[model samples]
Target: MTAPDPWAGILDPGETVLWQGRPDTRPQWAMLSPQRLTLGVVFIVAAALWGWQSAGLASAGGAMALLPWLAVPLLAVGLFNLAGHVLWDAFRRRCTWYTLTNRRAFIATDIPFRGKRLKSYPINRETILSFDESEPASIGFAFEPVPMKRSTRMKMVGFERIADGQTVFALMRGVQGKIERDFPIDPESLPR
Candidate 1:
């Protein structure tokens, strides 16, 4: 039997569900994400090199024992990139969920130790759409800058890292077209 809808009363009275899925939660440590991997690799290598030097220094003399302490942060940072990012990404994926309705898109994430987060963005005519056609395709829309206490993170709320993204994109495009046709967008309220 199929599972019932998770969103019971959250949707509009007549809003029907078009699609729903989650990101692939598999471990992905490829070089595609160069920033984290590169940073992680660099620190890890530095830590290793420093550790070796420290070992050599320790063997040579007792006064050189302070150099190895410098590698501590390097080792920590390296481990953070190499293992930390992977674990974090996996945890995020595991906790995330996506739902696309006729009128809006919903993102629900129940992050471990962070409690629940629910966000809904309407699928209006003024909304811009973009997608990454890679494995576990992702669609981005409803772009907004989410400001935190320290910094801002770009939050393009949509279905991310889902399988068969092309099909979902096509479905959403068709549904969005119908919505636009049924309710023609006014020039004054075009989200300027």
Candidate 2:
């Protein structure tokens, strides 16, 4: 079965499907609101103006007249920021991932241009569903109480508002239920 799109509720569900950790499947444009880029552009423009005014050179006036040239850096910075934000969003979505197949639950992390770490818990071994809802959500899977044994924890930083955090949690619960039913393990009994 195919997975649902993460942003289906926000965008055109039919047209917008998640790439499932595939970089090529991510949105071409930034996932962040354009307002962020607009703010960056404004700041860059202001900085350029300040620099132009402070130079106090006759040639600076000619340079100021060329606003388009001055805007080049601002535009570049804005685009770069936008791209970075998009990449960040894509990375978060990819990292905050859970796959439930007939066999087991597959959890993984994707670091753009870098390597990824993936782990699978046989339907029986996966006993716990734990997460941190702090400013940055930290999702993980563990079978032991010791903190170090739990390698499923994914560090998801910079995501202010998760697209559908509740739904994701619900899905995780459902998966946990399935694991419990199929396996004779008590999730709570597992070490922290």
**lDDT values of the candidates?**
0.83, 0.51
In candidate 1 the C-alpha lDDT for residue 116 amounts to 97
- The sequence of per-residue lDDT tens digits that candidate 2 reaches over residues 89-112 is 655665545444433445566666
* Winner by lDDT: 1
Candidate 1 regions exceeding 4 Å error are 1-6, 31-74, 146-155, 185-192
> How much is 14 displaced in model 1, in angstroms?
1.0
Screening candidate 2 with a backbone cut-off below 3 angstroms (N, C-alpha, C), the clashing residue pairs are 144-191, 145-191, 145-192
* Global Cα lDDT for candidate 1: 0.83
Q: Please state the error at residue 179 of candidate 2 in Å.
A: 3.4
Error of 1 at 150 (Å): 9.1
lDDT of 1 by residue, 1-192 (tens): 988876777887999888888999886766237677788899989988998878878766667877888899998888787678777777788899888888888889998688999998887667788989999898988778999999999877678789989988887788789887998878998687
Per-model TM-score, in order, reads 0.69, 0.34
